[model samples]
Target chain A: MTLILTALAATVTIVFRFAKQKTAEKLRLGLLALMYSGAALMWTVDGFAAMFAGEPFVELQNPSVVADDAFLGICVLFLGAAIWAVGLIFKKATKKAV
Target chain B: MACFVVPAAEAVVVAIVKKRADKAAKLQAEALACGGANAQTNTEQKARTKTHSGEKISISKKLGWLNAMLWGGTALLFLEHVWHGEVVFWPPFLTAAANPADTAAMLYEIATSGVAMAVLVTLVWAGMAIAADNISWVKAALCKQKEGANQ
Candidate 1:
């Protein structure tokens, strides 16, 4: 899972780098970023809930490990979404003026 | 490390996108400034409209929808996962519950799968954007070159 996520992150970064020239690309990249991050959050939360509800605490390897991971994931996801939102808003305001 | 990576990567992508936007805007301004005979040409008008329209659609409208869907879906799935405790849906309840390792495995599966999907989507979208931007630039440049040739 970690490997997959990392790969995806790398891919997204590269695409966004090339597409930066067009406003549409920015928005598309933003959207894609939000989607990926959001999905990550979902998986993290779900994983934790499943672990706590069904498995022994020892299975987690460390008690704080899962929670810490989830917390971090959520925070990052939120921040990305926020920035993307702001960009969208700016785009809109600019469009309205034109 | 994962935490740091995600945000840092996002920041970098955002920065690059911003730089591209700046360049495109500058090119546009230059095109406008060169307004003499070229500006009045049909091709010039079309290029101007196309670029602006592309910006409007890509950055403003499409982006808003993408962000909403991506973030909203993420939050919803996360909440559901938390609240429901990894049951996922109903049909597979028997299979889901039958295996003890299923929940953790499933979560892992989702986390990994979601990321992959996100990356794929991002790449495709970015590629399309780059192509469009280039096409516009090329069109404008060709028009200018044509005008020069005529003179």
Candidate 2:
């Protein structure tokens, strides 16, 4: 679930990038892109790991794995928020420069 | 244990970013102040306004993309998860069960995943708006470039 959600997030951003060419070219927005894409990648890897363990994204009975994934997904949200906050600060500082 | 890792990493990231932003702000302000006399201040202010608009355009563009990526991607992934039946709507997780523990779990789900879904939906709306607004500039730019090449 974590992987799937993050993957969708990544896809949305990519489509937005192409749809809005002018805005997509900025460096600050790159941080946002990185945050979502990075989280998606993490979830994808976790999914693969689950498959390796002979379960498709963990057996429904395994609360432990699901709990971990949920927590990780939450963490990814925080990380993305942090990156966004930093980017905004940077934007303000460079307001007149660029 | 690893849950703390993301927070720890974010703390460090925010701290470093704050320092850099502050330093840059101070330096840029100093340069602007010292590099010009009162007579040039008006021109500097004008320049600042120009850059401010430019910054707005830059930010709006990026914000649009961010909206699309985060919300859009999340939507797709969520739908996929639902289709896969990987989502467990158990007593403690998705609903307020008879037990207090289950109630807490239900609240947790409402707080996190529910909020995330709401946010994604909102961002998708905004992303569509911005993407639609900016679609024209791209076509214009391409057309102008082709015209220039032809001439």
Candidate 3:
């Protein structure tokens, strides 16, 4: 479900980026697409692994998978935020040039 | 140390950005002073009578707002997972629920997050409008100043 949501987010941002004229906005949108798409891909691989291995997909009882996924999602979110901050700098640059 | 180092780096970047912004604004004002801005320039007040109509919001602003909504929705979903005291990192989705009660809970969560995403998108759109308006106001002010000095 999280993966689906992340993928949806990626789609929305990428689609909207098409309409934007400014580079700064595009950069932020591109970063968002990268983050969400990456998270979604990670989850999809986890699902495939579970299917191949004949395991209950979620295995809520297993702290291992849950912990790992949560950690990864958090890391992705943080990384996205970091890139967004960098984009802010570029945004200022773009604004000045315009 | 990561926290300190990160902010310091960000601050330096921000300083550079601010300096550039001011310089750029001055340059644009100078350009407008040279007659880059004219009567035909888009404006909402004259839009009804004008052939091209008033200025439309830029794609960049729209995309920026959408990007914000995407992040907002993701954050809400993360919070929903944390609230359950367990992560649903893996998903058979409803099938993973062992009982009817668990299934109901899972469905409820999905519904809630779906609503949250919608709400976030709406809020972002409103914010974008306000920001766009502010930008226009600033531009109008700049145009007025340029015209005044010329007259």
Best by TM-score: 2
Q: In lDDT terms, which candidate is top?
A: 2
What would the DockQ be for model 2?
0.07
The per-prediction i-RMS, to one decimal, reads: 10.1, 9.8, 12.0
Which stretches of model 2 miss by more than 4 angstroms? Answer: A58-75, A95-98, B1-151
> Which tens-of-lDDT digit does each residue in B64-108 have in candidate 3?
444444443344334444444444445633232757777675555
**Model 3, residue B117: displacement in angstroms?**
4.1
- Pairs in clash, predicted candidate 2: A4-B77, A8-B73, A8-B74, A9-B73, A9-B74, A12-B68, A12-B69, A13-B68, A13-B69, A23-B61
Q: What are the models' TM-scores?
A: 0.32, 0.35, 0.33
Q: Give one digit per residue, the lDDT tens place, for model 2 in B43-148.
A: 5676556443322233333344444344433433443344344333564322235567766765554454444443443455455445543556543442333233
What's the C-alpha lDDT at position B41 in model 2?
90
RMSD of each: 14.9, 13.8, 16.2
Candidate 1 TM-score, true structure as reference: 0.32
The candidate, 1 or 3, that scores higher on TM-score is 3
Q: Across residues A32-97, which tens digit of lDDT does each residue of candidate 3 receive?
A: 664455345434444554566698655566687677656655554555556666766887798799
Q: Which digits, one per residue and each the tens of the lDDT, describe model 1 over residues B1-151?
A: 0111232244356556656766786787678767767664765677556544443223532333333434444443444344434443465542344566865655455455545444544554465445544676533433333343334
Poorest 10 consecutive residues by lDDT, candidate 3 chain B: B1-10
Clash totals for all models, in order? 1, 10, 2
Chain B TM-scores of the candidates = 0.35, 0.31, 0.38
Q: What is the TM-score of chain B in candidate 2?
A: 0.31
* Candidate 3 residue spans exceeding 4 A from truth: A1-77, A82-98, B1-54, B59-61, B75-96, B134-151
